[model samples]
Every structure is written in structure tokens, then in C-alpha cells.
Target: MLSDHDFLRYSRQIMLPLCGELGIKTLAKARVVVIGAGGLATVVAPYLVGAGVGYLRLCDDDIVSVSNLPRQWLYSPAHIGQQKVRVMAAQLKALQPAAQVEAIPEYADNSNLCRLMSGADLVLDCSDNMTTRQLVNAYAMDAGVALVSAAAIGLHAQAAAFQPSLCGPHGNHGCYRCLYPIDSQRAGNCQSEGVLGPMVGMAGCYQAALALRILLGDPNVPWSQLWRLDSTLGEHQLLRIQPDPSCSVCGHVSHSNASSDDSSIPNSGV
Candidate 1:
């Protein structure tokens, strides 16, 4: 059902083994929700739109500032006081007019998360703080939608994909809560710790890749595996995340049968 323009515009990716015309069409019909319009969303938005995602809902309550210019590529000096999602939506429209990008100038909190995430095929948690990430993860779990999350600060970055359906009684995937249950323990945000521009950009790129793979149903996508990168050292590490039956967010009575042995998490260099 691709128009001539769409086919021609996306022919390069359509010819790939993993992403044939079917994959491109799948992407064209996908509805995605992105949390946070800062560093990661700036990079993730353009890629999703350019690759033909049918719709994208961007949620953020922040405004552009001089400090964000180094990593957030969507804004400029003229957009200093403007809302982040508004600026991002305009730029994304310019990238691909056919894609429907909705800008919600609000944070993803208890009041509006259900409305924002309803009917989404996938959710990207690019939030800076643990509180928002935990909230988004719970929403995604209840909705049975996949969540791709990433973070960057002080030259180190991490990205992962989670599907709540894959974490029940017979499932093996882990949710965001399982990874970092205590919000007080996870601190270093980009604002206070400082981050290199390319560091967040790299994390964003990984997030985009994971999002696309999930949308395309790529069997090789590293579900629930945390990818860690050190930009300074040019090193990459992959950590397998185990499902926690005792997890406050995704745990259930039947899930208690899952292995809770946290002793042997496989680690490998990439």
C-alpha cells in the first residue's frame, strides 16, 4: 500500500534483508510515544519520522535553554523560551510531512500517561530521571507495549528494550523497575554530572535502532539486554537483564516461579 513517493523515499531500507517492503510498511503503520524532548528525543524523533513511522506523540514540559544546545540539535537561539515538544514537532514535520507528530507540552506523570500512551505500538523512555522512567515502565507493562529506554551522563550511556509480556510466569524479560528498583540509588543526571554532546547522541542512536528493530519484529533484537558504552574508552558491554518476580511493578503471583538467582548475569564485550 505504499505510494510511489513513499516507496522511492524509503527504497534504500526496503531492500535490506531484515527490512523488506513489509518492514517498511510495518514502520509506516506504527504508533510510537516518546518521553522527554531533550537530548535523546532530539535524535530519536528525526530518525523515526524519516524512516516512515506513521505517528509519534512527543511529551515534555521543558523549554529550550542555552545549556541544552550542545546536545539537543532541534532548537536554536531563536527558540530559547519555546516549548521543547513544539520546536521538535515543527522540525519533525519539516523532515517528513506525511508523519503525524503530536506535541504535548506536559510531563509524563500520573495524570496524563494513560492518555498519552494509549494505543501506542511502542514507547521510548528517554527520560532523565528515574521517577519518570519507572512511571513509563509501569504504563507500558499494563498496556502490553514494548519499551525502549536509554540514558547518558558523564561519558557513559546505557540503552535497553523491554516487553512486559515477556516477563510473566513463563517469560524471561525484565522491566525497568527490575533493573533499578530504588529511585534514590539512581542519581547522576545530565544536568549535574555533565555529558558530552556525542555521548547522548550515541545513546539516542542506539535507542532509535532498538525502537526500529522492535517495530519491525526483528528476531535478533536484544530484548531486555542492557547495552553500555563508554565514549571515552570506546568500549561496549552487553548485560543480560533477568526478570524479577518480586518486582513491584511487573511481578505477579505466578511470576514467582521464575528464577530469582541474581548471581550469574552473563557479560560480554561487544
Candidate 2:
């Protein structure tokens, strides 16, 4: 049911064997919620919009700052001091007026996370902080929505997809908490450790690819795969992760409680 304009707009993507008319239709109908309008979002939003995602909800409370210019490519010098969501939403609309773009000009906290994520087909965590990533993961798991979590610092980046269903009938695929372990410590944030702009873009692109695969119902791509790219070492690693028996989030016992109290997970200070 693609319109003439849509057919023309997505011709190149549609021509690909992995993404034909069916994939384009899936992309057009997908509703995605992206948390963070910073470095990763710069690449993700535009690609999603261009690919014709029906609805895109953007959440970011920060404003465009001069310091963010190096990594956040969506903003221009003129957009300095403008609200991140507002400016990014405007730019996305300009790129694809057909896509529905909602700008939540506030930080996504426990109070508003449910509202922001309600009815979303998928969620993308592009935020720099580990706390927000955990929050988003918890909420997505609770809502039974797929989540694509990604992070990049310096020349290193990691991307993973979490689908609750893959946790198996007994809740198998480990949750974010299982992967990081509540007691584990994180390094530092990109700001503190310094991140290369292209590295962030590379991670974001990987996230987008996985998100598209999920939307397209590609059975070959599992929901528990982790892709790591280290430009520093010129290495790309793909790890197959399984659910942990004692995971605090998606474990058999945790599934019954649906608790958000991950206080047991130690903060990595990232």
C-alpha cells in the first residue's frame, strides 16, 4: 500500500533483498520511541524518518549547547540555546513531513517514562548515562516492547537488542541487568572518557539496523545478540548472550514480581 511518493522515496531501500516492499511497509508502520536527542539520535532520527517510520517520539530535556556541536550533528550554530527536542523535531519534520514527530521537551524520568513509552512498538536508548539506559530497559521489559540499547565512548561502542519474548516461556534471554550485573561497575561517561564522533555514529547505525530487522520480523536475527565495535583496536565482536538464571530483571523469579527496584545493581559511575 505504499503511495507513489513513498515508493519513489524508498526505492533504493526497497531494492535490497533484505528490505523489499514488505520491509518498507513494516518500516512505515513501526512506531519508535527514541530517548535522547544527542550524538546517537543525530544519526538514528534522520535515518528512521527517511525510512518512513510512521511515528517517532523524541525525548530530551537538554538544550543545544556549543560544546555538543562536535558530536550532535543535527544542530547548527543557529540552534544553539534551543531546546534539543524542539530543534531536532523541527529538523526531522523538515526532512520528512509525512512522519509524525512528537517532541517531549523534558527529561524521561520514572514519573513520565510510562507515558512516553506507552504504545511504542520499540524503544531506542541513545542516552549517554547508564541510569537512563537501565530505566528505559526496565520500562520496555515491563511493557513487553523491544529495546535497542547502544553506547559509544572514545573508539569503543556496543549495541544490543532486548526482546522479552526471547527470554523464552520461562523468561530466558538475560535483561540489561543480567548483562551488566547489578554489582558490576561501569567506566566513565563519554564526556569524561572522551568519545570520537564517528564512533558514536557507527554505533547508532548498528542500532538502527537491528531495530529495522526487528520491525521486519527477520527470524535470523535474534533479540539477544550483542555487537561490539572497537575502532581503537580495529576489532568487531559479536557475542551471543543467554539469559541468566539469577538475573534481577528477566529471571524466572524477577518476572513474577516486575519490580523496578534495581538498587542491587551497583552503579558503574558511567
Candidate 3:
């Protein structure tokens, strides 16, 4: 049960038809793990906390650099040499003192992946590189957890929500590997390219939206759809997607409808 303060603080979110009191309470019990504390996690964490996600594990093993300040909104000159997760952890506490936010200053490699993701309700891949995305995808597949993956470089951004248990017939609803099978072929990253600050913020917010919808069990959401945003050109596109039948990560997935228990909102076509 939410205290009066919690209800008052999140009244707006609670008022939404999709996320009413029940949804808000569901969010309050949700546990989310975010990979990367750079541009995306900085904003994503705050949104999740603000909306009352009960617990959050923020994972990153990087340090704050002068170059990262332009996009990472949580840090300043004083935090230049500090650990990314630690600094963000403090900021998240300040945002919602009651929320439990842990700064796990470790990279999400195969060695620590399971530990990092254990008991997580949702995982967000806000990572900058393809390797991390692939690793996260494989882990999410094995754990049978939903994943919201997004990446932004320059003016282009791509995001998707992968719900393995919610797969559709005709081989629909694939993981990240379904779209980009080979890491060698999936090109472009922030390191090799320039990106606008709003671009990361934009993509991160979209990722947060998808995670919240899943947490709330919003029945109308079109799970496993690829959303592309072009901030430079002011264009956006949403394409329905499915897990690759031969995907090494989710190849064994069965071609059956999701359990009837899953919630869905009408595809608003927004």
C-alpha cells in the first residue's frame, strides 16, 4: 500500500488509465536493472525513481570524464573523476529518498551478468556499444526477463522492447539479435561518432516509457516493436518485430501466444 505522500507524489502517473493505483502499486514493487550510467541511465534512472520503482540497480564501471558531461545530466565539474554509478546513486537518492537505488560499480560481463540481473523485473540496455547489448540480450533471453534496448549516435536512435514470453505466432517478437545478427555488421557508436545531448535523452526517455508500460502490464503496448527516431530529421517510425527463429539467443523460443495473464493496451498507433 502506498503512503499518502507516495500517492500524492505520483498522483499524475496514478491517474493515467493504464497506470492507475494498481499500476502505480505494481511499479512500486518492480525492480529494474540499468546497464550504463552515461547519457541514458542518467535520465532513465530519475524517471524510474520519480515514478516509484521500488528498487533499482544501476551498473557501470566507468568514470566521469569531461567529454561525458555534455550529455550526462547528473554530473558536474565536482564529479569529473568520480565513479559513474556512485555519483548517479547519490543523485537518485536525492530525487526520491525512499526509493532503493544501488550503485554497482561493475561492468555487466558474462562473469557477473547473472548476479547483476537476478530477480530483476526489467532490464534496460542503455549501453553505448553493441557487445554489451548482445550480452544483455542473451542474458535477458536466458532469464526470461523483458528488455528495453536503445542506442543513439549522432542524430539517429533505435529502441525495442523484447518480451520473450509474449512471443506471437508466425515467428514474431524477436530479440535484439534478430535485427542485428552480427556485431561486425551492426556499425556506428558514440565513440566513433558525434551525438547531440538531446538525442540520448530522447532515446533514454523512450526506453523508460517502454519499461514502465511493461511494468504496469499495459495491455495495449505493442511488445517487440522496433522504434526508430531521427531527431535531426524530425521523423519517427515504429515497426513490428519478432524474435529470429534461428537466433542463437532465443532460437529455442516456441511459436505460441503469450500467456493470457499478460496485460496489453490497444495499439494506439502513437
Candidate 4:
């Protein structure tokens, strides 16, 4: 049952046909792990927290820098030298005091990724690099947790949801690795190609919306479909990602007695 305060706080959201009292309750019980505190996270975290997500674990090792000021709205000139996770946590707390926010001042890696995602109901990959994204994907797949991934660079942006468990028995949606094979090095990121605030913001907003839809068990949620946008051209495309049976990350791992190595995979700019 929602308390009087919660009822009032979320009155607007609860009024939506897709998100009634039950959806609000479900969101309140969901545990989410966000893998970055940069541009995408600056938008993703606050929305999830504001939506009443029960617990959000924010993982990032970077500190606020002048270069990030333009896109990372969560930080300001006063927070230039502060750790991203710490500053982001404080801001999220201020946004929604009822939401539990855990700030982990470290990058997601093999040693800690598993532990960081242990009890998460969902994982959001908002990291800017391909390495961190792949690492997050592997861990999420191993834990059978749903992952909402988004990235943007230059005038292009992309967002997708990889929910293996949520897909029915015959669902053939692919994991992140399946979509961008380990051998590919084509992803461009903000640092390399440069990006406008609105481009990154668009991807971040889509990630937040996708997360909410998944938590509410919305059947229309696009699983394994990559949403691509070229803001400069005013074009958008929804491409289905066909699972790769030969994929070493998701497919070949189980059939053969071997562990998949992701170290050689090139860095993605996103």
C-alpha cells in the first residue's frame, strides 16, 4: 500500500493507464544497477530514482571534469573535482529521498561486476566505452538480469534492451555481444567524435523510458531491437538484432567447454 506521501508524490505517474498503483508498487520493489555516472547516467539515474525505484547502485570511477560540464547535468562547476558517483548520489538523494542510492566509487570490472550486479533486477549500461559496456553485458547475461543499454556520439545515438529472461521460450533476441560481435570495432563515442547535449540526452531519456516499461511488464517493450537515430539527418531506424549462435559471448560458451575472453575486443566510442 502506498503511504499518503507516496500517493501524492506519484499521483501523476499513477494516473497513466500503463502505470497504475500496481505499477508504482512494482517500481518501488525493483533493484537497478547503473554502470556509469557520465552523460547518460546524469539523465538515467534521476528519472529512475524519481520514478520510485527502490534501490539504485551507481558505479563509476571518474571525477567531474570541465569537459563533462556541457553534457553531464548532474555536476556543476562546484563539483569539478569531486567523484562522479558521490556527486550523482547526492543529487539523486535530493531528487527523491525515499529512494535508496548506493554510490560505488569504482569502475565495473571482472573482480567486482558480479558482486555489484548480484541482486539487481535490472542493469543499465550507460558507460561511454565499449569495454565497460561489454563487461556489464557479460555480467548481466551471467546473472540472467535484464539490461537496458544506450550510447551516443556525434549526431548518432543508439538504445536497446536485452532481456533474455523476459523473452518467452522461443524468443531469439540477441545479447549485446551478439549485436556487436567481439571482433567489431566500429562504435564511435563522445570523446572521439564529439556530441551535442541533446543527442546524448535523447539516448538517456530513451533508456529511462525503456527501463520503466520493462519494470511495468509492458508487453510492447522492444527486446533485442536496436533504436538508431541520426539527429542531423532527422532519421530513425529500429533494427532487430538476430542472435548469433556462433557468438562466443552468449552462444558458444555453453556448447563447448571453454570460457570466452573479451579482452581483445576493441574499445567502442559510445
- The better-scoring model by lDDT among 1 and 3 is 1
**Poorly placed runs, candidate 2 (over 4 Å):** 168-171, 183-187, 253-270
lDDT score for candidate 2 against the true structure: 0.81
What's the TM-score of every candidate structure? 0.91, 0.91, 0.89, 0.91
Which lDDT value does model 3 have at 115? 85
Number of residue pairs clashing in candidate 1, backbone atoms closer than 3 angstroms, sequence gap of 3 or more or interchain: 0
Residues 28-94 of candidate 1: C-alpha lDDT, one tens digit per residue: 8999999999999999999999999989999999999999998898999999999999999999999
lDDT tens per residue, model 2, 1-270: 778988898999899888888888888789999999999998899989888787899998999999889989899899999999999999999999988999998787677887888889999998888777877777777677899998899889998999876763365576676677543236647867888999899989998888887787877775777899988789998886777776766664333236544653222211
Tell me the lDDT of model 4 at 32: 95
lDDT of each: 0.85, 0.81, 0.81, 0.84
Q: For every model in order, what is the number of clashing pairs? A: 0, 7, 11, 3
Scanning candidate 1 in windows of ten residues, the lowest lDDT window is: 261-270
Judge candidate 4 at residue 130 and give its lDDT: 81
Candidate 4 clash pair list: 128-270, 189-269, 189-270
- Candidate 4 local accuracy as lDDT? 0.84
- Candidate 4 residue lDDT tens string, 63-109: 99999999899899999999999999999999998889999998987
Model 4's TM-score against the true structure:
0.91
| Candidate 4 deviant stretches above 4 angstroms | 166-170, 183-187, 253-270
